[model samples]
Target: MLFEDEKTNSEIAKMLHIGETTFYKWKNNPKFIKAQHEYAVYQFDSALPLAVKTLIEILKYGKSDKVRLQAAQIIFKRAGLFSDNGNPELDKAKQRKAIA
Candidate 1:
């Protein structure tokens, strides 16, 4: 139900009859963040726009490359197949050669 048409935290809080502060506290919990990330990916695969919104939400609070990688993977998987030719992960040297 997290991916329902109304996906904002405020909207969810209202639907669940919880205060915004409670919702924020829940979102800050590690367990809740992990679960929410997984649910967001599932919703993304189901073509829910809220999934993308959720990913962005998670990214905003993420503090590590691991989290960013997870977000990137979700985006890549949903967008299309990728190849090394245009890989954005490459170093500057690789990018210059590719550009040349």
Candidate 2:
């Protein structure tokens, strides 16, 4: 019901002849809340491929360096090429210093 239809909570409750408070109370349950979060993640995962493709296009043909750099940063981050401090070079330098 939540995924198939984009109805509001009040609408869903009304259709089931329940009150708004009842709807909210049920929605606030831990399991129900988890399902909602999982469904949202599922929707985003389904669209992620298209989003990645568009970001690639922006990186390749963006009108300005600022825009292209931003896109490139996102791609790098998603590709697991970033370090904890967000700078791969800095991370390498730190590793070398620690070795020394």
Candidate 3:
């Protein structure tokens, strides 16, 4: 509830019938932090397939060329083929091609 809930800490605390200080203590606890991290990972994992599908749909069917390009860039960046610092794998591939 602490994670998936959109309510503020105070509001959630009120709903949970706990004091604000207690809520803060729980929120700051190591176990709570770990649980939050795991929950977030699960949520992201569950959404990943749909997220990829949406990105593909956008890349293929976006109304504007700019939007389609942005989606393609996102896909490439996530796949490690595009990066601001340049990809070493890509450089290695180019070097191999040069040798060939």
Alpha carbon lDDT of each predicted model:
0.71, 0.80, 0.84
Ranking by TM-score: 3, 2, 1
What TM-score fits each model?
0.39, 0.68, 0.73
Worst 10 residues of 1 by lDDT: 91-100
Candidate 1 collision pairs: none
Q: After superposition, how far is residue 44 of candidate 2 from its true place, in Å?
A: 1.2
Residue 90 in model 1: shift from native, Å? 17
> Which is superior by lDDT, 1 or 2?
2
Where does candidate 1 stray beyond 4 Å?
1-7, 44-83, 86-100
- Model 3 lDDT per residue over 1-100, tens place: 7666788999999999999999999999999999999999999999999999999999899997667777877888888887756487965664455445
lDDT of 1 by residue, 1-100 (tens): 5545558888889988999999889879999989988988876678767767879877666777566555765676667754435445564454355335
Better by lDDT, candidate 3 or 2: 3
Candidate 2, residues 1-98: lDDT per residue as tens digits? 76767898778999999999988898899989999989999999999999989999998999976677668667777889854463778755654554
Clashes of 3: 0
Q: Could you tell me how far off, in angstroms, the CA of residue 26 lies in candidate 2 after the best superposition?
A: 1.0
- In Å, residue 32's CA in model 2 sits off its true spot by 0.7
